[model samples]
Target chain A: MSKTPIRLTVNGLPHEVAVEPRRTLADALRDDCGLTGTHLGCEHGVCGACTVLLDGEAVRACLHFAIQADGHAIRTVEGLAAPDGSLNPLQRAFWENHGLQCGFCTPGFLMLATWMLEQPGPVDEARLRHVLSSNLCRCTGYQNILTAVRTAAQELGKWREGATPA
Target chain B: MKCPPFDYHAPRSQAEALALLARHGEEGKILAGGQSLVPTMAFRLARPASLIDINRIAELDTCRAEANRLRIGALARHARFERPVVPGPTGALLARAAEHIAHAPIRTRGTFCGSLAHADPASEWCCIALALGAEMRVLREGGERLVPAADWFQAVFTTALGPDELLAEASLPILGPDWRCGFAEFNRRAGDFALAMAVTALRLDVAGHVAEARIALGGVAGTPVLAREAAASLLGAPPTPDRLRAAAALAAEGFEPTEDAQVPADYRRDLVRAMTRRALEGSLAA
Candidate 1:
């Protein structure tokens, strides 16, 4: 297979790489861009471990080709932190609320939450649970993950008022 | 898993895409959202020699209500319908059904026309398309034609689409204010493929009786099947609880469900009955 040179803007930085047409965006981000924070649990779309924001929308990185993401703004877990490497609100909530046991699925969860919170309006508890259910978390049984997201949502003023917390 | 080696072509215009599809013929596959196609490719279930990516074609990314129908272009993503995109009962029905599709990430990139083109038996959009009598616009290299929903779906993972054709747009009838729609599906978990599902659309007469009813079932057959007998049973009558149950029973008894290791034939029949009743009841509540 011949390599197709494509430009990917990751975390507001432009990086040009030549990848084969068969290469997925997940692989290109991890191998070529050397950003391995975005994990790949299942190459299939069932697992949300490879979730990323493509042009400000959440999509499974494994399900999209590297060439398909060409010229699009790609955001990964590595882009969630400040320049001084301080934990963002969502990441801090995970830490304070014990969101992860093994931490393998944390990055995907963080990226997914980032996209949800960026949307307009407050997040209702039911709707938040529904959206967060898109990704699977095996270690913590998902209770703590839900708490972490709610905690972060409250801090960011994105949580709906009067919505009872679980 | 990695996709099988294939040449990629991103056509900037619909005409260019049609030309590429014509040239590659059977060896070419259209890539819209790639949510389903890319996964199957990664698993090596489908190894097309060429990929005709239509995402770059700006003309195809449209979803608009024109007069009596909602014109959904091939590039209309599923997430676009999370909220009612149009006014009336049709938009509400679409919003309700779209919420059941996969999840947020999958919906963000998956295209509605692509879902119809995939023709999965359990797809929510397929059931809605069949129930709403959608018209699919197919474009070949130099010609085009409209295919009604009845003639569109042939079998599971198959459709009326030809190897050299592209499903350019789908037009769903914009139901009137008098119409009410209900959608119900059974899945073990959120975002899982539905085991069985039903879509119902009813237009009430002045006396609040059933003037017209349209019902479609999914996941019980190779394609979404219209419940003609069940729908006919509800004509000229008010949908009481007992009446709904009888109609649901009629629907369940009419279908010869395909069995699987996980879902038995009788179990699917039960699901059909339950989903049909629930869908009908939901419409009445609206």
Candidate 2:
């Protein structure tokens, strides 16, 4: 198949690229755009390894096409931390609370955690658990992960010293 | 490593999209968020000659509140409902159901139309839509048609949708003030399909009496199945624990769940009882 023209703003940077119809967004991001922070595990969307934010929401990049994104804004784990390689508060909270175990599913978990924290109004623990249950983490069993989310909620709206490059 | 060779088309408007579908017929597939379609393509499960990306069509991405119902376009993603128009128990039950679908990322991109159109018996949206008595609007090249929840879903991964038809929109009647709603489902893992699921909507007057009740079950049947006889058990009765228990038992008695990783058919029937009872209690509390 011939390559299709795709123009998308990925990780805060706009890129105009050519992709075949067969390629998925995960392959496009890592191969065409050189952003490898997003890992591909379980090419099927069962695992959270390939999660990324498309237009400010988390979606399985492996299950989407590059050309399909077209004019949408896409964000990856690489876009979450500060531009200076500094850790965002959610990252620090994860580190402090030992949220990760093997770390393969860490990026997806972090992206989901960050998004959930941004949601407005009543954040009950049970409700929060139900919300986060969609993204799977095989290694850590989610106990520590839940702890990190709880700890982060306790320190809500307390940003670190300088803002990260959004 | 990737999906098979196929043509990609993005129509600017709904008319253009319908034209594309009308032309391609069975060889074309409507892409709604691609949550289900892309995977179906990657695995070669559904090999359409052309994958028409309908997400770009402006008219398909809307959540409009009609005079007496909520009209959701086919491309409206699941995550859009987290912050709903109306809030409270019984009010905006669909929004609450949308939240529990997949993960935040899937919910963010997975359209409820896609979820329901995908026709997964394990999905919460299908069961919830049926329990709420929603109407699915399907548009064809010649004309349009409306399929109620009962008629829309047929069997596993099957619906009444035809080859050249596109699911245009789904309209659900907004819950009244006297209604109480509850949703309960059990899944082994967070994002995986449910082993057994149940949803209930009840309307009670100021005297706290049961005026109407609707109960539906997913994951335990050929399609999103409704337990109407069980619901009838609650009709014309007060909202008491004994009455609720009897109704829940009737609901459970009717379900014939299949054996799978989650549980045996017998256990799922028992689970139906527990889930239905708990759902009733929760709805009453709301």
Candidate 3:
């Protein structure tokens, strides 16, 4: 019934917004922060369409209140690309591998994959499948998504090994 | 779906949180992880007039493993257990169970104690807690109390927590060196709630006979059911194939299961039997 002032850093940008206690992080990001790349599919916790990074961990923004995210760092799909607008390796891999169809679930997948790629060490097909199981993609049947993630993991690993750092 | 408007208070300390809870009483709900509560609020199933956000209370986020138990603070996220801070078989079991909770994001936000407080009959935490005989520490304005996991869960979506009380932490008993643990569940898909699940910890004596067994099943009852009869049957006896099958059968007995649109009661009972068998076999092999 009351508004709460919140300060959050979104995609390296500091934001201060006054919102009702019930306003979800996803709603704040889309409506208030003007970042619409984060999709809301189920609204409930089931669908990972509202997935975003909170302090570097992938979390369901819809499941978090905007006030709860105060003083936290958030990274949405919009932050995945370079500042100059070049697609990241994961995005490029998805594009080349036909990882997305309909694209409603791509943002969630991208954020989730980004979190996975951020982890240290090599990711095998089994680990990738297990991590990707969290996000659902009605279209593409997931083979292309798996291929895309695998390709991106390889590319990212090579980049990390100092092979033409992106 | 959007959450209905509610007054929010971010308490900085446990005392402040308790005072807020006492003042607001039933009208106030403690928000931790907000994975289950937020979705329920969005669906209008639960509408507390005020929310007491305890995430800022640093004292409530502690996770320490002691000599005999692993003390997990209420705010400790499920993701933490995926790579447990504690060592040994208990931590390994918790990590394995954490992997089966929901999705990665849900795991990142959901808390172990929050899941226990939510008391979903099919929750992995509920089953694990019951199997491990975890003790839930409750705090209030007056004092603090510890409730055993056996008496904590009352029914589906219900627990022993009072309106003015908050679950502060859960202390799960560590598995002894002689004990081995196994967990198995039957879900339609990965990340979905289990239709039926079994968590088992067994210890074998020097003579290759079952020295101790703790078995718990979920989704087949209103609360996580401890298979006392099944566990008792294996005591002092070799867990042979026939003996294990009989015990698993006993675990599915004396319970009335609720039938939902997705799964029938009979199917759930079958799953309970199968899962119990698998869990016992896995523990034995471990």
In model 1, the runs with Cα more than 4 Å from the true position are A161-166
TM-score of predicted model 1? 0.98
Candidate 2: residue B226 lDDT (0-100): 86
Q: Comparing candidate 2 with candidate 3, which one achieves the higher DockQ? A: 3
State, as a TM-score between 0 and 1, how close model 2 is to the true structure: 0.90
Q: Measured by TM-score, how close is model 3 to the native structure?
A: 0.96
**Per-residue lDDT of model 2, residues B1-286, tens digit only:** 4678888888888888889999999999888877777777778888899977888888898888778788989888887786765554434676666666776677767887888788998888899889988899999877899999989898898999988888989888888778888888887766667777889988887667788989998888878888888887787768898988888899888866777774877888988888888888877774
Over the full model, what C-alpha lDDT does candidate 2 score relative to the true structure? Answer: 0.81
**Would you estimate the TM-scores of all the predictions?**
0.98, 0.90, 0.96
**DockQ, all candidates in order:** 0.91, 0.59, 0.77
Q: In candidate 3, which residue ranges exceed 4 Å CA deviation?
A: A158-166
Q: In model 2, which runs have C-alpha deviations exceeding 4 angstroms? A: A81-84, A92-102, A120-132, A141-166, B87-90, B205-208
